[model samples]
Target chain A: MSTIARSPRRAAFFLSDRTGITVEMLGHSLLSQFENVPFDETTLPYLDTEEKAAAVVRKINERASADGLRPLVFSTFVNPQIRFVLDSANALHLDCFSIFIASMEAELGIRSSHAIGLSHRVGQPLDHGRRIEAIQFTLEHDDGLSQRNWQQADITLTGISRTGKTPTCLYLALQYGIYAANYPLIPEDFNRVELPAQFKKLRGKLFGFTIDPMRLHRIRSERKPDSEYASLKNCQYEVRQAETLMRREGIPYLDVTSKSIEELATAVLHQAKLERKIY
Target chain B: MSTIARSPRRAAFFLSDRTGITVEMLGHSLLSQFENVPFDETTLPYLDTEEKAAAVVRKINERASADGLRPLVFSTFVNPQIRFVLDSANALHLDCFSIFIASMEAELGIRSSHAIGLSHRVGQPLDHGRRIEAIQFTLEHDDGLSQRNWQQADITLTGISRTGKTPTCLYLALQYGIYAANYPLIPEDFNRVELPAQFKKLRGKLFGFTIDPMRLHRIRSERKPDSEYASLKNCQYEVRQAETLMRREGIPYLDVTSKSIEELATAVLHQAKLERKIY
Candidate 1:
């Protein structure tokens, strides 16, 4: 066995603005991308004040210089006052990273896609009356459940069975505290018009999800063993029909193939721009 | 809105060594302990060879020098040969972190009351079979039907309803590709002296999960309003009884109330000291 002992180095990160917990989580996920590196982490919240921002920068620069290290800053200082604070850090030649800076072009480039806007992604911003109405209709259509308890749902995921919908929905709810509710699209609804009547007037807020025909066919085949529902031909027809319906009706949708749970959820949220109800 | 062009600094972390993913996740979570700074991350697989270890260290040092930044390294290098390669990075003076270094003392510090030493931790000898058992069981339990397919199940989850058993089990199967089976622990099982006959004979490999009774009560109440199953009294009784059963049977278990899904899963794997099947 070989022994090597050295004092660990200190590389600091500073946040000049208060992006709140969202940026914190995003940063955390980003750091998880690196597991082989060791450095201490520190956060300075509520950097809206120039005094606080400057203080953070001063501390970071001091730490980096004293330890012969560099600091990485993840910030979103949209306010001009905050700009002065970061400008101070820049004078010190500190390294910084803002995801917005990297992703702005990518975000703008997405405009050309048949993209669904945010409000529709989060159920179309229904009025209280409409929300209650939609809930009642959902209850009536499905297991005859009551609406008194549905508001507690952080998010409701609605989709067809075997679409990997339930697992994904539950993942959102459990992992992110998004009370997602999923509704199955049954065989009878294949050609139905007006989108269950409840979803008609609320079309603006509706989000649709679809999967590859071949994959769905394989998934169904695993469940029933030998059934027409699992037939690739039927799956292709259904997928095409579903896509056509979504396009014609202007329902926003996502293709979940080849996406992990985190990526799919993040993409959906990014598309919906859902104001996270819980941290 | 004022426009302030502030670049957020990005930090990459790589955790290489035994069960590197756990260290990666923990390091990420620990960032939460610091509520101010934000990070961007990249995790590398375990360095099983000296060549890969050297290449990784070289690449990281190069990135650090090129970016004019020194990144943090959090790893658990087990193979002495790999450690030899990693040590060479000291020439660049990068901030290196090895969870193994912390874990060695932390493992020893685990309270005797806690069932420690049952699983392979950072510095423990590899127990590849237990991990394979967990993984195999998880795979067989895929998509929540493995309970019905018990014979094919390698690891089974038996718990009262809404204890988060299903989703957790599915995460193990889906994320880690482990086949995990889940069985409901009903009223009858609560009264039994022996585990399900299947598990009774396999007590050494069995695991029990318990959560805060109040949380369990709240969750169940949501599902079956005003029903006895959702009654706080029932939840308390079941949890107490389950604890007693586990203790009597010498079955290892975890209290999952305060833990996140990832934490709970890792804690269980850590407690069971199961070897990871993933390469």
Candidate 2:
């Protein structure tokens, strides 16, 4: 009879010479293939210098010591000096750039311009500029501050406070270059049977967000401790009232209590029929 | 005589039931594989409804007619009703979900969730909360507003005004849950020979951003037209002096004339040897 030990939980690191998003995304996509194995992740970006590489090595070694297994590192370190130091760490390194760069250099019969960069919407500078413009517009028009600019906005988000409003608006703006504005609903506004003055003219552009009262209570408690706003009873009252208002007003809404920001944002875009205006 | 038309500058669309980012990314990656072919793209996201789907079909038909070639659509539409409408369009439809989900269900012997969703990091509510906290922190610490929380930040960005400071910091916070902060360099700081007073205690966490004088002039002129601050001479002066100050201070900086916010944020993390602490 033979005794076998189960595979220990693994630690993974997304290490990059730059923002590390590309490597992280690529690593994540690949790791998702192994659906059965569980993993924990950390991202260490901007690993540009030898000293920094050494520090990362120490951290990796510490993790390896604690876990009794080597960690997996997906790295795009362009500089050879820093890459060499990182390679010395007690972990498995997946080098994304050097292998691909070499093959492309061979195939194209020209040296690659490896001036340390990330993989993104490449060769679309205009699209990227639009994204930045949308982000700026979203920031300027956030939280009912610039309701008059509804003509310029592609979508307007409305909800009671702390129902994942700002993050969704920012996500839509940054990811898709859609000019998004958000408005908060207060308790005083709940008394009215009709929509707000600004929203009266913005029915087609409006989208609402709602959350479970329990989650709202937890979020509010963290934001403001020991207040009427944070009480569970107040949370239930507010959510019930807000949902009723949205339904009566015929505004499309999403319940975000069980959803991440990405999921909430996705539902909003789908239900509101919002197109990405930038790319 | 036979004449070959110039491929009619083929058109492509990324269509989805949600945010369309996944389809866009996948379509772009596949399109990049065909280096010799040139194409124009439009993203039709949130096409979940019958009306929206019909509109997309019309747009696709119009593009095909205008381009004198059949358009290519990369779609992730989940609903059969919307998908049926989109499938009738005059284009080659590459249905992402149907092709993959069917095979996955067959292999796993289970029905896949058909909740129109985009790809993202999942099952990490803790990480999500961290991202929100980092965003709040970054907002509070923007433009040197709250220097008292320097200890809480993983990185601090310094640059001349409008040199892509706030956006990059916010991007880092939102995307990677990195507690990032930014400080603006005014004319007064240009005269100094060393780093600013607040950054004196933050050597390891400091990074810098720079932009080309012409680009800076263009950006500023649009922000404040016909002002001395937007003058080419003033922009050139400030950029030169700012670069010198950063160099003298031994702070690494990048020129942001051509890079997107994504690129800039990535570069800052790589060059600064910064790690995202939130996740």
iRMS for all predictions?
16.1, 7.7
- Chain B TM-score (model 1 vs. true structure): 0.51
- The segments of candidate 2 whose C-alpha lies over 4 angstroms from its true place after superposition are A1-23, A33-128, B1-20, B32-128, B192-196, B277-279
Could you tell me the TM-score of chain A in candidate 2? 0.67
* Segments of candidate 1 deviating more than 4 angstroms: A1-162, A200-205, A222-226, A276-279, B1-147, B160-163, B198-205, B211-236, B274-279
Per-candidate DockQ values are 0.03, 0.15
Model number with the top DockQ: 2
lDDT of 2 by residue, B24-60 (tens): 6655544554455566877777677999899888989
Q: Can you give the lDDT of residue A165 in candidate 1? A: 49
Fraction of true contacts retained by every candidate, in order, equals 0.00, 0.09
Q: Worst ten-residue run, lDDT, model 2 chain B?
A: B118-127
Candidate 2 falls in which docking quality class?
incorrect
Q: What TM-score, over all chains together, does every model reach?
A: 0.48, 0.71
